[model samples]
Target: MSGRETGATAYLLREPAAGDVEGFAELHVRVWREAYRGLMADEVVDALSVETFRPIWSSIARAHAEGAVVDDGRAMLVAVLGEEPVGFVMVGPARDEDAPAPRQVWSLNVAPEHQGSGVAQRLLDEAFGDGPGYLWVAQRNSRAIRFYERNGFALDGTQAQDRHDGVTELRMVRPD
Candidate 1:
């Protein structure tokens, strides 16, 4: 495991309820700051706020409950401990114009404390599954890249600058 593992504990996986937005948003900021410490400018990462993501999570939850997940290969699941989300995974139709696969892993994040407790893998499997897909990982994000590799993704000589943070990202694809 790339991140530290405390002994495993009981955790729940489920669809994100509207009430989970605050916790999920906080988790998003925490995971990004922890995971991208050296890879992104501190100011850029620090500027991220839970307020910015609350509506995003709310909309996602509402969409899911409305049965909007039937098409587009979209799915998301959160790993929770009590009322807080320890980790989450989101997948959907690939957004790139020349995407390698129809499916894309939009995001997979776990709090630093929960990193190696298998919560990440559980969320990933519950959302992304074994189907063909692709994802972009920051070039120097070795831990995430390795995890993706272990799950059957491999670099495909493609690169792009992240629109938000300007980080270089490499494309990895899992073929059908």
Candidate 2:
């Protein structure tokens, strides 16, 4: 599916191809910095780089091309606006042992410019359908928590510390 706003050209959501690795990696780093800057330490945010993630994306693209299922059992979908990759979502089997749902939203990110343009919702709809799922979100990221709530997820009272930075994350789940 694609989204058509007033000024911006419509964006298409599709399975990412190997050629998208570079763009995806770049977008990932940019969005991570923009999204986590205030929530995480400056040093942690500054440490993010495209180079660190490019190899991982390359591996994903390779596995996708070779018809090998992602070891994490997730599907990676990218939103392309013209030639630029604007957003992406990763969804699959729950990684947490105690998750209430069978699936989880491993990640969802949109460029700052496209944040309020419905790109995230479109990606969520495409990736999650009407089924139940769950995701861990930074407890302090109110925008994302509200977005998930508006999309039918509710706080499940489960919390954990992120292993890397020790930031708190809360679990949100959608009923089956």
Question: Model 2: how far is 76 from its true place, Å?
Answer: 1.2
Q: Per-residue alpha-carbon lDDT of model 1 for 107-172, expressed as tens digits?
A: 998989877787888778778889899999999999999999999999999999988888999999
The sequence of per-residue lDDT tens digits that candidate 2 reaches over residues 1-176 is 55555245577888878998999999999998998888888988899899988998898788778889666557888899888999999899998777799999999999999989888888898887878999999989999999999999999999999989767899999998
The candidate that wins on TM-score is: 2
User: For each candidate, what is the lDDT?
Assistant: 0.84, 0.88
Clashing pairs in 2: none
Cα RMSD, each candidate: 4.0, 2.1
Worst 10 residues of 1 by lDDT: 1-10
What lDDT score is found at residue 124 in candidate 2? 90
Poorly placed runs, candidate 2 (over 4 Å):
1-8, 70-73
